[model samples]
Target: MKAWFARDYGRPDVLRLEEVAKPVPKPGEILVKVHATTVNSGDRRIRACDLPPGMKTLGRLALGWSRPRQPVLGTELSGVVEAVGQGVTRFSPGEAVYAFPGGRMGAHAEYVLLKETGPVAHLPEGVDMQTGAALCFGGTTALTFLRRGAVRAGQSMLVLGGAGAVGSAMVQLGKLAGAHVAATTSAGNLDLVRAHGADTVIDYQKTDIARLAERFEVIADTVEAMDFATAQKLLTPNGRYLAIAGTLKEMLGSLRKGPEGKRMIAGPADERIEDIVELGRLAALGQYRPHIDKIYAFTDMPAAHAHVDTGRKRGSVVVQVAQ
Candidate 1:
């Protein structure tokens, strides 16, 4: 099997494509013949082993200390089951599926394994492997924020990176929940975000998000590091301040403030299998869809990583590993 492996963490150049042994399924695990996989900001961050002050120590302890604990970089994948381990009873060979291999990094190859109890779900009817490949992180991340924010009908939502993969999905999810959605993007994506259901568009380059006259009941931010005081000020009372991009300290600070407005903020919600399955249902229902920015051939994993690292992708970046 040919797969991209990370020998030492650094740039996309660190990734070398070579033949490697295909992974086998362990008890309760399923071996998948990968069709496609997608990259996320979290993937890049991990490759670089970039964590905030105290977080680095935690990562070192969990992953590898001196070098990368996991040699492969890909996380979310869409594939077909070639074999199901002994303890696995729900799925059989040849069933199409998708999943997040929770903390492990082997999805960027032709074969990867995961426990059936992980975030595995059958591809939603009419949802092809390409789209399924891209949904795990974007969907779960969006779902988590919306749930934590507890967005309700008729409320207003402001997504900081609306044209982005996760942000675009949030726009759709927020609108489906009956919220008037707004998103921040450059002039290029003004119409695109609107089409996704964002009622208002903020030119983050030209307009000051912190100074917008209209506030929101829920603001979903994926740009990570935004001023808490600024976002908090824009929320309606009992508003939820959700930021997947914000740092741990920021989230904790908002939580501790005990301020009004569900000012409750968080990232990556829970990675429950049910949540992913639910997201697939929503995609099948046309409420949420994969916003693909580009699809690169599996060998071009380096190029894909470079694009994601630039933080300029319009949506998710898909890597076609096999199909």
Candidate 2:
């Protein structure tokens, strides 16, 4: 087996391809022959050791005191069940599947081990490996956050950084939920956001955030590029601000909001097995679409990471691990 290991924390250059031992599934687990995976924001942040403000030391400790605890960086994958271990009856050999390894990321390779009852699901016959892999990261995150926000139909929603993976998913899901979606992005990516179903697109470079035309029932700042103190004025009463990336200060503020004030929601998306299954169903029905910004070959994993590092991808960046 071969895997791309981040030898150290720094840049995409730190990731190197090395032949390694293939892993077998443990009891209650299944062995997947990875067909495709993605370079998501989580992978980029870990590879670069990027941390939110005031959490640098904590991030280092959680990831590693000096280097990464795990060398492989992918968080989600679409693959085939090569074999199922003893006691695993949910999946059989040759079944196509997709999984979010969550905190146990080891998918940047030719093979991976996943628990049969974990966040793993059989891919729909209509969904290809690339789309399945692409859907895992952003689709799960967007769904998790919107549900947390208690978003409802006919309400207005605002998504900041609307052209990236999570943001694009947010726009599409918001529209699916029947909300009036507004999103912010660079002028170059405005059309991309619109294509994802954002009813109104704000060009961040040209428009002042405070001057936005309408207050929103839900505001999701996916990239942490906006000031919540000022953005709060843009929220309607009883609205919720979904802080996808919150600093320590913002977290504390979130905890201290007045009882009568709009709520501030900040937390990591919980990648649940049920959500994966639901997203898979939606994909099968053609209601959920995974837009690929670029596709890189397995041997070109480094280039894929480099592209993600640029922070400008309109949607998912997928790596084809097998034909």
How many collisions per candidate?
A: 6, 0
Candidate 1 — worst ten consecutive residues by lDDT sum?
Answer: 261-270
Can you tell me which runs of candidate 1 are displaced by over 4 Å? 258-264
lDDT (10s digit) by residue, model 2, range 1-323? 99999979988989999998889888998999999999988999999998887889988888987789998989999999999899998999999999999778989999999889898999998899999998878888899989989999999999999999899989988899999999999999998888888999999999887777689988999988676676678888888888887777677777866344788888778878988998899899888887899999999998998999888887999999999
lDDT of 2: 0.89
Among all candidates shown, the one with the greatest TM-score: 2
lDDT of each: 0.81, 0.89
**Model 1 agreement with the true structure over 200-312: per-residue lDDT tens digits:** 88788999788888978887877763666777788877777786776667657665644674465764457878778987898888778878889999989999999999888
Q: State, as a TM-score between 0 and 1, how close model 1 is to the true structure.
A: 0.93
RMSD, every candidate, angstroms: 1.9, 1.2
